[model samples]
Target: MVTRIEWLDAGLELLATEGAPAITIERLTDQLGVTKGSYYHHFGSAGGFKAALMEYFEAQFTTRLIDTIDAENAKPRAKLEHLLRLVLADPDNAALEIAVRAWALQDPDVRATQERVDAARTAYLKELCRGVGADVDPDRYAQLLYLILIGAEQVLPPIGRAELREIYNLTLRLID
Candidate 1:
């Protein structure tokens, strides 16, 4: 039997590869080699699946990363580095982000989800900046960092992971 996580994972994969428009019940069922009943059993409808998928994205991408970094009990700068490493480790992450950002532009619900994710990530960055005792304003610095990442993901062809990682390193160095 296909589980809820399997459905959500397939939905997320479809979202990342083909944008939100491709995430229909038919596509998910076909992609997962399951029946419509399976999709309905887990999500009730396409809208329900999208909603759950966004929640899953937010939790997996934001809260889980923060929790994982926090669990390290490292110093602030170390945690910051750890965060960067963890983010860069997943190449699919950038693709998913780009797809999601595009989806946000055309969907109100998606935009709201994107906004919350941005706010949460920026808030964490601000906390880390303060903990790192940077001389710059934490809010501005955090926002700047967050903006760079968002901008990077939206640019034509998008920034490659290695280049983006270097860009992050340079930005982080500015406060170091």
Candidate 2:
């Protein structure tokens, strides 16, 4: 039997594969091979389902990226580099980002959440820049790094893990 978490996961998969327009309660229920009653048991309505999805995405980001970066043993530089590598390594993240961006265009709540995520990521990067004693403003460097990382997701070819590590190392040297 599928759990509520499973339904949310399926929703994300559907969004990633078919785009936001394709994710309706009916479609999701059909895809999950469950009835509308089952979906409603988990989420009260279509809006409720979307709200849950946004929350789910936020939690996933928190667990997968935010918490990882905040580990007590990880240095600031290591955190920043790990963030870059994680973003680059995830095959689905680029698409997920694109989908969320599209959703944000229509939903104020989503736009706010997106901004919050960007802010959190930027704050972390700024701390890393400060730790490294970079001459430029940490916030500015953080925004620059954020743009570069997003650009890499959109424009760069698939990079091997070792190659990405090398690139991150070289980029850090430039910043410092």
Best by lDDT: 1
Whole-model Cα lDDT of every candidate shown, in order? 0.88, 0.77
The estimated TM-scores of all candidates read 0.95, 0.86
lDDT of 1 by residue, 44-159 (tens): 88789889999999999999999998898789889988888898898788889988889999999989999999989999988888888878887898888778877888788888
Off by over 4 Å in 1: none
User: What would the per-residue lDDT of candidate 2 be over residues 10-114, giving only the tens digit for each residue?
Assistant: 999988888888899878888888888888888888888888998898778644587877765876777777777776676677678778878888989888888
Candidate 1 clashing pairs? none
- Residue-level lDDT for 63 in candidate 2: 48
Distance (Å) between predicted and true CA of 147, model 2? 0.8
